[model samples]
Target: MPIEVLPVRPSFVARVIGADLTALSPAATAAIGTAIDTYSVLIVPDQHLDDDHLLTLGKTFGDVEPPRNHRVVQRLKHAELADISNLDANNRLRAADDHRRLDSLGNRLWHSDASFREVPGALSMLFAHVVPPAGGETEFADLRAAYDALDAPMQARIEGLAVEHSIFHSRGQLGHTDYTDAERAALPPVLHPLVRVHPVSKRKTLYMGSHASHIVGWPMPDGRLLLRDLMEHATQREFVYRHAWRVGDLVIWDNRCTMHRGRSYDDATHPRDLRRVTTKDLSMLQPA
Candidate 1:
């Protein structure tokens, strides 16, 4: 069957059908790439994708990086391919917002993948291994729209603004979000233009991550006030989409121009498992 791309909302997501990426024709593979460029989020339903298939789909874009800690593999799955959920050492389930010790990033505000690092991610693939009866919806905001929505004066004011993004500032000494000291050491603070240029589409996008602590060289209070104001304003309802999950639902999003956050899940009461993979194709975007 030919591929079908159905938009969930005119502005944001698309439900992709008619092609199996795990074993796609050359034309179909190219089609998925084009779909990614046009729609930031592509949802595939009832895809019983195994790790191999998942890896195949990710490689269609760029190098795959998996997270490093898991009972599933020895020495870890790298930092890019991670099973994103709250499962403890014993492999028991956890609550969404609850943090035990210094482990798991399930307790964050909002972020784009790896914006704190020198080379941020280009795409994110999340597969719903399991879903709870309620909760665990993921939310995404369209940054291009956010940038376009700002008033002219505000737009001009932030055109060249830069921010210091650091994971250290986010986790601190506790270091529980699964990165070891050595791993964390490998990642250092980086600067990102508040407004970035999309490489393929040649559009401007808002570039803010949870790891962004403050604007460079700005006073703390002033930075915090401005950052908070912009974040809240950009993430307003009109510019966002919330996705409810179902078993076998796979979500692929353009990390370059989207901001995503996890909604609360009934962690303590039920088990939810989601596998995530990240892609870093810097050629798709340029530093502003």
Candidate 2:
């Protein structure tokens, strides 16, 4: 059967059927690419993919981002595959006060993946290996739709503004200050337009996320207030989609036009294992 794209929500997410990502033809790969541009989020069910298969599929889209400097090295075999689980490198559940677990708590805040990087991220592929019985859902907000709903005055006010982003700033929000000097140096603050124009769809999108620190030229307090206000407005119920994950499911989302956050679960009791592979956004070169 041919691949099919069916909308899960009226605004942005869709469920793709009839395609196996591990054994995709060139045409099918192109079709998935087109669907990503049009739908922004695609949920492919029953995909039994391993690390190698995940990395292979990620390369088909663009250059996959490799593991960066961190206090604990990623336990995944490949540097390109990110470990998004609540377990330690030994495959055991982390302690309540583990530094890595504390740092990862920032994922619960709504943010775009790799938006703190200078090049940012284009697409993200997150596959579930183990899912919790309840909770642990991911919620995505459609930035394009949120932008469209903004009043003309608010849109014009942020039209040419630039926002500085840093991964450290985001983790700091959760009182996570255990980063090594090397880790801090590896990821410095980067600037990007507060309002970005989506390359393929040509739609305007609100770009600020939890990683965003402040408007480049605006005072810190005022910029922070404006960012908080925008986040509140952009993540309204009408623009959000909450995804309940299942094992063997692979979810692909365009980081350029959406922000997502992981919901809380009984981390101490349940194991929710998911791995992510992100592709760099070459189009975001020289963020202005």
Candidate 3:
């Protein structure tokens, strides 16, 4: 049974209608894989998924990425479920000045999940348990579309370029340097091509985000400037989608061709709870 999908945009983004993620038919599952390659982002509403269910669904995509030590308390049971929320270990809203809250503020920066790693993330499945009354929407930019919009000469210039990405650099941008020495050592910088061809779709997509520190082998200042310029161009309104989250909604996005960021909400006054699981990109094991 093919899943019914409504396109949110001509180039990317769609809403999967009336499909129970927990009990997918083989045909439906294949349709979803096809949808991901075509749409890059899918919003599935009215899902009832627990941590166990989320973990199971994530495995259908690929190897689930393990949780990284951000020096924050582990609120969830599964090591694969990332605690994407404003609550503490006790399930209460965190203090406005809590270190965990401060560190999470980096999610507001446009970034592809796990781009700083040696093996970058492929798909990010985020499930909304509770959403704030206002704000807190997630925005995604279509890197394939952004890349296509580039002029021919600009495309040729960056065709063979690679970028050095670092988790420290992105967190440093927000003055949130509360990392433990062990955490710092675990998350050293890595290199990835500036433009990578999608394994399934074969479209050239820009592999950049807040984690992208600078272009490899270029002078620091020049590399930073180029990265900044590319970021500005890639995130133009024409290539972006904003998702206003609702409770029970699960959004899945392809990190291979998209960058996303969370919008601002009143963290002190309202509670916004979401959990995420990402899959590792196997294409990363091969040459990019």
Candidate 4:
């Protein structure tokens, strides 16, 4: 069957169908890459991909990020994949007091994956192996549209500004501050442009998210206030797309141009497991 790209929103997201992700041809891979660049989010439904298959698909884009090494957090055995589940190492439901579960609560806040890192993430591909019966949707905000919607004056004001981002800052906001000194030292804050231009399409996008602590060189209180304001403007209902997940679904998004958050679910009662692989930005890999 020929591949099909169906738009899910007037701007930024699409549902890609008719291609088998497990065994994609070089031509198919190229087409999918083009589609992802054009539509920042691509939803491929009814795809039953194991961890191996998911990682293989991620490699087509760029180097997959190794699983984050949190000092006290336990991750899946494989270093390449991140487990986005509520289950413990034994595959049993985690206790309410579990640190892993507490850490994951940070996901409810809007964020672009790995934005706090020196080499920020480019793309994130998540495969839903199991889903709850209700309320586990992932919401994405269209930063590209958000940028276009800003007033000329507001755009001009932020043109040359940059922001400092840190995982500690974001998780601390959610009251999940159990990071050891070592862990905090390993993830020092990084600076990125407040407005970034897409490497391929050349479209500008608002790059601030929950990970963004404050604008660089600005007064702390004022920087935080401005960050809050921009976040509010960029996530207005008109620029958002909420994706309801299904088992066997794979959703890939461009982290560089969008912000996303996972909605609440009954994790204690319902099992919701999703595996994610993120690719590093190609620009970061290029030698100066």
lDDT of 1 by residue, 135-205 (tens): 98899988889888899998898878889887666665235465567766777788888888888888888
The model with the greatest TM-score is 3
In the predicted model 1, the residue pairs found to clash are 65-80, 65-81, 66-78, 66-79, 66-80, 66-81, 67-81, 95-267, 102-176, 103-176
Candidate models: Cα lDDT each: 0.76, 0.91, 0.92, 0.88
Report the lDDT tens digits of candidate 4 across residue range 151-235. Answer: 9999999997989999988889988899888888988999888998888888988998999999988999999999999999989
Question: Which candidate comes out best when scored by lDDT?
Answer: 3
Looking at model 4, report the run of 10 residues with the lowest lDDT sum: 69-78
- Model 2: per-residue lDDT, tens digit, 151-253? 9999999999999999999999988888878888889899899999998898999997889999998899999999999999989999999999999999999
lDDT of 2: 0.91
**CA error at residue 31 for candidate 4, angstroms:** 1.1
Reference-based lDDT, residue 107, model 3: 92
Residue 285's C-alpha lDDT in candidate 2? Answer: 74
TM-score of candidate 1 versus the correct structure, residues matched by position: 0.87
- Candidate rank order under TM-score: 3, 2, 4, 1
